[model samples]
Target: MSTTTVTSTPNPSVFGQSVTYTATVTGITAGTPPWGDVTFVIAGGPTIGPVTLTQTGVDSGTASVTDSSLAVGSHLVTANFVNSSDPLDNSSGTTIQLVNQAATTTTVTFVPPAPVCGETVTLTAHVAAVPPGSGVPTGTVTFIISADGPTVTGTLDPSGNASVTVPALSVGTHQVAAFYNGDANFAASNSPLTPLAINPASSTTTLTTSPPRRSAVSR
Candidate 1:
């Protein structure tokens, strides 16, 4: 009979990140190494391959494969050994692999660098997956202004951008920020606080010219 054990590197990996799994078969008699292939299977997931085992010692052999297509969830991984050139019985091993959402960054900006009181302004938020993890982040983003300001939500587009229009901001310095409600493939994130200044509306003046022009014409 033979015993098989399986393990993974970077057990808890991020979505779309590469992971390697290895299986080792042992329990053979001294001076006799096990020979055959090992197949990997994931519960509720896809099957890897029938990778050939490499002889490592007198009684043990190993096989390994790298994969990067697992979704964000906990997976039950199993390795089954198939005996081809040995008299040992087939064996299997099981292990758990965890996948987490990719990290994200959120940024908030406003159109029209300068704004005036009582004018409508558009606030935009952009979300992106952190390095080592790729793909555009989806879902909604919430926009917030200073205390007492309205809270608005906007759905993201294909480019990971969301926008909301805010009308009638009082004249003063207001802090604005955006929070991204992450999707299944990316983690939530918040943008740094940004200060927006809304200056008071421009004042208007009226002037009148009187008899000075008439006196000069008479002269």
Candidate 2:
């Protein structure tokens, strides 16, 4: 009677990394053959694998093998070995976790410098990219402008840049806030933006709106 099993491994599973776990097998028949066709079953929801082992000598029930980590989490492991041609295999299982932690956290920010009340200013929301290193920026930036009250309706440009068109009905100072719509749960001020009183100066510019991104050409 012999046994074999593995309980843990080093992770980060880089391109060329290997893991090893102990296999404890005891009380073997003096002439009993070593376990063959050994396999491993990691008891978490992740990839599965198995390997073949070469016996050092007869009746030695202990051996070790290297494995590559597939995921991070608690896992129940099983070590399987076959000693008889009858096909009734030997196996064991245990639990462990592969912990993977991210280094960067998400922080929200706003754009357009500062708030400009009583004016149709162009604004954009900024989300600092990941890794916080490369000078290159990626991902689509969202744009949003909200009037403090229902008085003024704000809109955005093709580039998700927002330009306020203080309509005629809205009077007095309207507070405008821009948010990133990149994700459902993601929204923040691109700096507190405001629309000047929809009186004369702003109204004089004419509420210019291009027909949705790409629409019929207008003369």
Which one is best on TM-score? Answer: 1
Q: TM-scores for all candidates? A: 0.80, 0.37
Model 1 off-target regions past 4 Å? 86-88, 131-134, 201-219
lDDT of all predictions: 0.89, 0.42
Alpha-carbon shift of residue 190 in model 1 (angstroms): 1.3
User: What tens digits encode model 1's per-residue C-alpha lDDT throughout 1-219?
Assistant: 889999988889887788889999995577778888999998756798899989999899999988877888999989999889664579999999998999999999988768998788899999988866777888999998996578999999999999999987888989998999988979999999999899899988999887755545654
* lDDT by residue for model 2 (1-219), tens: 455655555543221134565454432557665655555665543334445455555655545666543333334556666654435446554545343321211222223333233434343343432231111222343333344443322333343343333323344454545443332212222444545333433324557676667668889
Consecutive 10-residue window with the lowest summed lDDT within model 1: 210-219
Give the TM-score (vs. native) of candidate 2: 0.37
Q: Pick the candidate with the highest lDDT.
A: 1
Q: lDDT score of model 1?
A: 0.89
